[model samples]
Target: MAHVTFGGKPVTLLGNEVKVGDKAPNFTVLDNALNEKTLDDFKGVRIIASVPSLDTGVCDAETRRFNEEAARLDGVSVLTVSVDLPFAQKRWCGAAGLENAITLSDHRDLSFGKAYGVVIEGLRLLARAVFVVDSNNNVTYVEYVKEVTEHPNYEAALEAAKRAK
Candidate 1:
């Protein structure tokens, strides 16, 4: 279990967080179109899994920032994972005009959140995390935000993705 904070309140996350050297576990998540997407589809690119809550302000900003930044970078794909429904995610993206990265929903299985060790047990929400996976499917960077209310170390994660290539 991992301990994280939301708005200064400590929260516990279920399952184990993946280490930098470990091969990321396979996860099934739903795309904005409600299509199933797995890690296999993103085999050869640097991937940044940004877990967020669309209902929150910090998460909203994080997604927007990464969406713009991730679009400009080549050979890197940013996937924002949330528990929000597909319709809500699609609506939010359309309203925000976010195109660089993809927003995925884990409401159906809740497996992605658990597998990623971002699921908050009692709260039924995911802890904010930024995981960077290299082309070889090795986890290169991991930041389980100590304070969910705060933003992630975007520069560090981005650098790790770039350096991994």
Candidate 2:
């Protein structure tokens, strides 16, 4: 597992760490409507972003940026996963005016977080990371942000999504 920090303090991440060229793992998460959704539910090129919480500054900015990029990236689907409840996620999206990025809640179980190796042990939140999976479900790019409070490499993830499409 890769070393990560939350608020400058070392934190342990749980689950199998993903890598480039590896097949994307399938995990269940709740949609804004509280509907159960899985990896297979999203098709085509995907930019899966895992954040500690959508309420935080970094996570908010990251998701907003991806939501904006999603409009420009043809055939790419951007999914944001967090531990926030589905209702809260829905309210946040509405208030933020985010239309493109689909926010999924992993609170019911750390299904998405653990499957992607972004679960922050003891925090019940996901570590900041982004994964770009191709149409074939092969991971083409992966970025585990070292600091939980920082934004990810948006350009790299966007570029990867473009390539995937």
Candidate 3:
């Protein structure tokens, strides 16, 4: 379990984030259309798992930023996961005109968040985290924000993902 903060208050994470040398965990999440998707479906491409909660302002900023960045990368795909329902995710994405990254809902099976070590126990939200997986399914970069209210290191993450050669 990893330790993180929500609004500067200490909060404990349930699971462990995929380490730099660890193989990415295989899990299923629902797409905006409510269709099931797995890690294997995105093989041979750089994957940036941006786990966040749509209910928070920081998460909203993170998702929007990633959505814009994801569109510029040719072989990279960003999958944003949240506990919100697919319908809500669709509505937000459409309203924001976010067309690059694919937003997946983990409301049904909290397993994805659990496996990624981003689940907040008491609250029904996910701790903010960024995981970059290489084409071989190995985690190349992992960042679990110490403060939930803070934005992630987008520059470092984007550079790492873009350097996959």
Candidate 4:
């Protein structure tokens, strides 16, 4: 369980909290075209960024930042995940001019949130978090942002991705 706060109020998380050294769990998410994507689909270093919803301001900015960083991270795959529908994710990506990072949807079943322990129990949203996966499928770093409405540590997450790569 993750102790998280949404809008300053403590909220419950409904899944197991993973940490560094744990094998990254394999879960399915929908891509922009509604295709199923799993951890196995992306090879090499992986940065899995979780957000509550992409429609929000914080999430939009965070994802765009990651998209900008992704271009610089050659050979690394960056995934921005949210509970928003795939259609909405596609629209957001297009509107934001995001091309480097992939936007995935966990709205179907919240599989990614549950597998990554980011599921917000009450709101049915995902808590902000970031996970770095090495080529060997091992989790090298994990950050569960304490505040849901705030931005995550972008520098730290990028550093971990670089190290893992």
Candidate 5:
């Protein structure tokens, strides 16, 4: 179990924490079109960013930053997973003009949240976390933000992706 705080209040996570050397767990999340997308679907380096909701200020900023990063990175897929509905995700992406970072809806089953160990048990939201996976589906970086509202280390994650073996 992982401990995280939201609004300065304690929150417990439900799954085991993933490490840099661990095999990345496969999870199924819905794309904006309601198509099921799994970890295996993506090839090459991937940055899997988890957030509570896209509507929140912190989540918004984080996703937007990743979107910008995604635009500049080559052979890398940036996926922002949230608990919002598919329609809401599509709207948010369109409104935010996120062309590179894919906003994935994990509302159907929260599979991504649980598998990634970002599930906020009390709020039914995912904790802020960043994971970098290589072409072979091995975790190269894992960051479980201590606070739900805090920003992850984008530079570190990007570096890990670039250094992925």
Candidate 6:
């Protein structure tokens, strides 16, 4: 498992830690409309970004950055997963005017968080991380941010997505 921290304090993460070259784990998350979504639903290259909550500052900025980048990345689907409720996620997207990236809620069950090894043991939130999965469902890039409050390496993740077939 990757060592991570929240607010500079060490935190334990639960689940099987994902890594580059591993097959992307399947997860069930709720879309804005409360529809269940799974890994198979999204075709082509996928950028799966996990965050604690969409309400927080770091998560907000990260999602927004991905939204902007999604516009230029052809055939790439950017999915942001958080423990925030579907309604709250929808509202945030609306207020933020985010069109390119889709927000999914893992609040019902830590399905996405646990599957992707981003679950914060005691927090009931996901640790900050990003996984770029190619069309074949192979994880091409993985980034587990050491600090939950910081943003990920956008350039590297984006480059991996571009290279994924």
Candidates in order: C-alpha RMSD to true structure: 1.5, 0.8, 1.6, 1.0, 1.1, 0.8
CA lDDT scores, all candidates in order:
0.80, 0.92, 0.79, 0.89, 0.88, 0.92
lDDT of 3 at 69: 83
Error of 1 at 135 (Å): 1.1
Give a tens-digit lDDT track for model 5, residues 1-165.
Answer: 656798899988977789889999999999989999999888999989999999999999989887787667788888999899989998998888874458898888989988888888878889999999999999999999988898999899888877875
TM-score of model 4 vs. true structure:
0.96
Against the hidden true structure, what lDDT does model 5 obtain?
A: 0.88
TM-scores, each model vs. reference: 0.93, 0.97, 0.92, 0.96, 0.95, 0.97
Answer with 1 or 2, whichever has the higher TM-score.
Answer: 2
Per-residue lDDT over 40-98 for candidate 3, one digit per residue giving the tens place of the 0 to 100 score = 87865555554556656877888888768866887887888888899988888887777
Query: Between 3 and 6, whose lDDT is larger?
Result: 6
Q: Estimate, for each residue in 1-165, the C-alpha lDDT of model 1 and write its tens digit.
A: 556887788887886788889887778989888899888777555555556577678878888887677667788888888889988888888877774458888888887788888888787788889888888788888889888778899889888877876
> Which ranges of candidate 2 are over 4 A from the true structure?
none
Task: List where candidate 3 sits over 4 angstroms from the true fold.
Answer: none
lDDT of 1 at 15: 67
Candidate 3 Cα RMSD (Å): 1.6
Which consecutive 10 residues in model 2 have the weakest lDDT in total? 92-101
Which scores better on lDDT, 1 or 6? 6
